[model samples]
Target: MADIFDKKPIAAFGEMAETGARPYYRTAAPDAIMAGCNDYLGLATDPRVVEAAAAALARHGTSCSGSRILNGTLPLHEELEAALADFLGCEAALVTTTGFQANLAVGALLGPGDASFSDMANHASLVDGVLLGQGSRHRYRHGDLDHLERLLAAADPDAGKLVITDGLFSMEGDLCPLPGLRELADRYGARLVVDGAHDIGLLGACGRGVAEHFGAMDAVDLFTGTFSKCFGSLGGLLAGPAGIVEYLRYTARPVLFSAAMSPASAAAALASLEIIRTEPARRERVFDHAERLHNGLRALGFSTGPSVTPVVPVHVGHAVPCLRMWQALHDAGVYTNAVVAPAVPRGRALIRVTPQATHTEEQITRILDAFAACGRRLGLVPERAEHDWTPVALARPKLTP
Candidate 1:
């Protein structure tokens, strides 16, 4: 019999890994600078967060060893869920072992004959979640509410409808129009679900997320988030109405069958959540770094699409050039993620960089300087623009559609 594994195509990073070309997987490099990681608040290394994990390891042992529905319901799990619910201003919350699993749980709630409207650029977890439900999926253009409204108008009004989108798009780094989505949901009698994986602890006046940033927190029906990014820990949360959460607690496959989240992860996430609530300076500093980095890149004439948050992308138009650009940046000691198809469309390859609150002025300057050098050498941007490049405004106001 033929081997099944031979049919699987090799991944893009396989070549790099085989050659030991930089050991990007390991973070032990003495001088490596990370501009590509998702640790937005810089709390992953906080002493308090570390201490909390240590305490949990000592107190609860390592693992819950079973699913949450059975022997796995620990006190720490309940405490973290309550904390997440309160932080997101929701009636209840469920903590899962991973953010991907959290999205799957929400997706699994959709039944046959139900309908789901997703953004073209939504995270893969959201896409996979919709597939799990085996419902009709209608994907609208990314961030275009007009397209979504048109699609919704043609769907059967009586069918159960779920509209799914990312609060802050991870790759393009733009905020979704939540108010418009809510208005559409109300008009069509659909439920609005937001995956705030990249938004929570990094947006709004108080970092409540995109819904709060847009003053539509009360309108969103389901809010899903991850602890891996801002919390600097390993877990996921689904916060929403009490009845719905209670329903998913027993129905979602991952929660019903998978092992419970590790004790250390729960404790660390709890500690990080508390810090996010109390320290407004971290959020402020993150935006400060983002503004400086965004402005500096735009000044150099690199196209950064409609980004208002810390996640920034350098739009290089093809795959090979993007990889080349990444290699150049890597060789220069700056670490960034080079994305290509199908993370993005063909010919729309780009480099993604994220800045954290812990990054200093000198660090930001070094990142910019390296980009300027590599960008000029690659001819990705003009050596000097005859006229200054105009900066695109953060986000346009959402009007009634």
Candidate 2:
């Protein structure tokens, strides 16, 4: 038989060495600026965070060796969960092996005659959670409350309903309207769930997430987040009322079957969480970097959609031009993610740029200069005018894995 993986799109896959927020790809030199990593607060390589992880590794070795429901439960896990619940203002929280599983566990709450209303542009994990559940799924246009309301109005009056959205969209770099979602969920007698994977440690006064950013902390019924982003570690968490969390603790397959988060990851996440709480300046610096980059890209005439978070998307229309621009930037010592196809709509490709708190003003200037030169060379932005480039409408291309 022909190689099953031969047709896979391996062009996007590559090996690289990462140190904290900076990545050293084989195609780029050591000094390449990483604008693609999700280490929003730059705590991944912090001495304190690293020390915590090292200590845990020395104490607990490598793996937890079992699921959280079994012998895998550790004191560190409980401590991290408690800290997370307290930080997010939830009554209880459960830690999972991965952020994807945390969201997947949401499906445990769904049953026959239930419904989940999701944003069209929600993360794949959220989409998969609904798919794995027995409940009916309804996806509204991204951030469109009217479409959500319509779907809610059409659902069975007695069915359990969940309105799920990402606190901050990873690819688009836009925040979900939490206040509006909360209002609609209340009006429709539905529970609201916000996935804060991309927002938790990078948003709000206390870094609680978009719910806290919009002053809708109590408005949301459930909150999910990943440690891989802002926490500078690997794991996931789901926080909510004690009763519901307890139910999933014993019931959700993702939590019950998967191996528990390693002790090192748990410790690192705890350290990072503490840092996020105490260091308000880190959040400030990240927001500053985001603003500078966004404004800089926009001023160079790139179409950066409505994004006010650290995740910024530079729209570059089709895949070919997007890859060309990415290559040009890579050659110029600026690294960014080249997002294309199914990650977005068929034709809406973009260069995903995420600035870290550790980046200096001088580095930000260099990044902007690289983008200005590369964008003009690739014809992805204007040569002179500061006006946003009008995205071309292209035919939908056939998608592949």
Best by TM-score: 1
RMSD of each: 3.5, 7.2
Q: Quote the lDDT for 351 in model 2.
A: 88
Model 1 Cα lDDT, one tens digit per residue, 1-401: 89877775435455445433443354634686889989999999999999999999999999999999989889999999998899888999999999999999876778877899999999999998898886678999998899999999998777899999999999989888888899999999999999999888877766778987887779789999899999999999999999999999988997788899999999999999999888878887877788888888999888787788888899998777787788888888889888877898878888999999899999999999999999989888888855567665543222211
| Model 2 misplaced regions, further than 4 Å | 1-28, 386-401
Location of the lowest summed lDDT over 10 successive residues in candidate 1: 392-401
Candidate 2 lDDT over 128-243, as tens digits, reads 88887887889999999999999999999899999999988999888898888988999989999899999898777778878777767798899998999999999999999999
lDDT of 1: 0.86
Per-prediction TM-score: 0.93, 0.91
Alpha carbon deviation, residue 98, candidate 1 (Å)? 0.3
lDDT of 2: 0.85
Candidate topping lDDT:
1
- lDDT scores in order: 0.86, 0.85
